[model samples]
Target: MQSCFFSTSRTTNDGSNETDQEGSNKLSKDKSIKKNLLHENIYTIPNFLTFTRLVSAPVVGYWVLQGNYTDASILFGIACVTDGLDGWIARRFNMQSIVGTIIDPMADKTLMTILTVTLAMQSLIPIPIAGIILGRDAGLILASFYYRYISLPEPKTFKRYWDFSIPSAEVRPTMISKVNTAIQMGYICLSLLAPVFDFTGHIGLDYLGYTCAATTIWSGASYVYTKDAVRILHPPSNIKK
Candidate 1:
């Protein structure tokens, strides 16, 4: 009778042990699944910062259209700072995402292009300045098309230290591109502020505008030249030689 009792007790303990182990395994799997889902979701803090810039673009445009240069300048400055902050946060925190990459630059180009056109329409800035900025942007677009069609190279999957390929092909933004953006943003803010602060008549605005124009040209040219050189040196094997 005692042997029968001992056997029964042992069986019960064994079954309990098995159930506990299974539960532990399931918990671990659940945690791992949650972690993977979190990583795939792109709503990080840095991306939030980028979103702020996107939101500000329309507000800035509205203010400009309303002839409120002062408020527009302030909002533009905030957007510019947010751009820098988001990038710095992403790099520092390793929070870079494909969405952030696309939205950040799009927000910048949209805001600047709208402001440039609006200012020109108001005769606040010289038509020549707006023309030069637009011309550089158009040239970059053309070069991008040429690279895509004429130079059909194998898609590079990795970025090198000195690689400056356009982000449409690969999602990485070049350091020089970031610098150029910063300079352009600075110029826009200053230009907008000049009239609000009664500095439009001063010679400084002209000098700054000229400097901004030159930088735009140089940066655009460099982008095209770098992409062309990379395509030549590292043509994708899939592309015909």
Candidate 2:
């Protein structure tokens, strides 16, 4: 009888031990899954650089407004360099994210627009020229939003706006756009340097400014004239069969 009782007790304990191990394994698996989901993917090198540039926007504006062009130019140079660095890291490391795509351009636009507007208001740069650049950027922003809204899954409610969908809004700067960006930054830097070094006697700053303005208008006009912008603005209508 004692032997029979001992055998039953051993069987019960064995089953309980097996169940505990299984439960532990399941808990561990759940923890691992959660860790994977919440990993620090956003803290990548490229994103960090982009974030730094974004933060520099306000600081650059403050310096420009304070009449401290020297420091402003310094920080602006860092912003421009980081812009390229982040892009390079993103492409080389395959660490691109939708958030990066949105934030990167946003940071650039913020920096450029804020500095230009502040300087223009101070009568340091041409107001009409700044208007053109700002206007172009504003249009692109609206177009991006318009394209993005169409890409979402439509509601089941009886509605037919369009059939096709773009995956995401892409910010593909054309060759001229890229050149314009470089010249734009260069002109801003030179403008800032003019105050520090006194270049009123020369027309270098004016020359660069005119070039930047021309490129800005040309790039913007190219977008409008090209079919790309129109297609993005007006998606194809859904044809119900």
Candidate 3:
């Protein structure tokens, strides 16, 4: 997640609604909340662009798998451009939202994850490199949801899909994590370009693979070892000591 990894502060609604509500009440409340959030945040230009990037992920990966490097590279570049533009617009125009904060990196991650898998399947990238990226992200995502579930009151009956607040301010990115993402993106771009065009001697897509793996692992470990993420996710309640 290139976006902010840490929320500014920690908060908890310790209150609980143990009693069940009527299905109608639950559905109406869910619809009402979704209506409000979408009305307030979904219509923004930055978010719209972000959504475009999200939509582009599968298309980009499909092109890669089909061995259409030209189209894949072009679509990937467009997605990256849209990502950059959304961030700039959001910050420049003060259009930032909790939704943006969460979805921005999610879009990036989704695109990269899909691309990585597709490329790895085609042997463009090493399995270990792909593993590091996917593994770290997979674990972290589950962790994010776990923490969010712990921090909020999960509805008994399903309603809105986007009614998640777990990817909150606290779930932020680190400097190295951000750099790792950039390098991974760069590596993918270079990898795709290598097939279509000639590049200089040793553009280092190979060596960069190891670098990404190490950094991805370290970034995940750093989050827990540095006590920033673990304290928030697990806390001291379960500590035997």
Highest TM-score scorer? 3
Q: Per-residue lDDT for 1-241 in model 2, tens only?
A: 4775443322255456555666689878777654443232566899889989989999999988998888998899888899999999999989876557667878888898899888887677878878887888898778766656664334422233221221234455667777888898887767667778888435878888888989988887776666554232222343111
lDDT digits (tens) for residues 180-229 of candidate 3: 88888888888777778865235476888788888888888776766554
List lDDT for all candidates, in order.
0.66, 0.72, 0.73
Tens-place lDDT digits, model 1, residues 1-241: 4775443322345466555666689878777754443234467887787778777887887888788998898888788788789889999989876456556766777788888888878776688888988887776556545544433333433442113322223234455665766776667777678778877646777777787777777776676556433232232343232
Find the 10 residues in a row with the least total lDDT in model 2: 157-166
Better-scoring candidate (TM-score), 1 or 2: 2
Question: Under the 3 Å rule for N, CA and C atoms, how many clashes does model 3 have?
Answer: 8
- Which rank order by lDDT, best down to worst? 3, 2, 1
RMSD of 2: 11.3
Query: What is the TM-score (0 to 1) of candidate 3?
Result: 0.72
Model 2 steric clash pairs: none
The 10-residue segment of model 3 with minimum total lDDT is: 232-241
- Stretches of candidate 3 above 4 Å error? 1-40, 153-157, 164-170, 198-203, 226-241
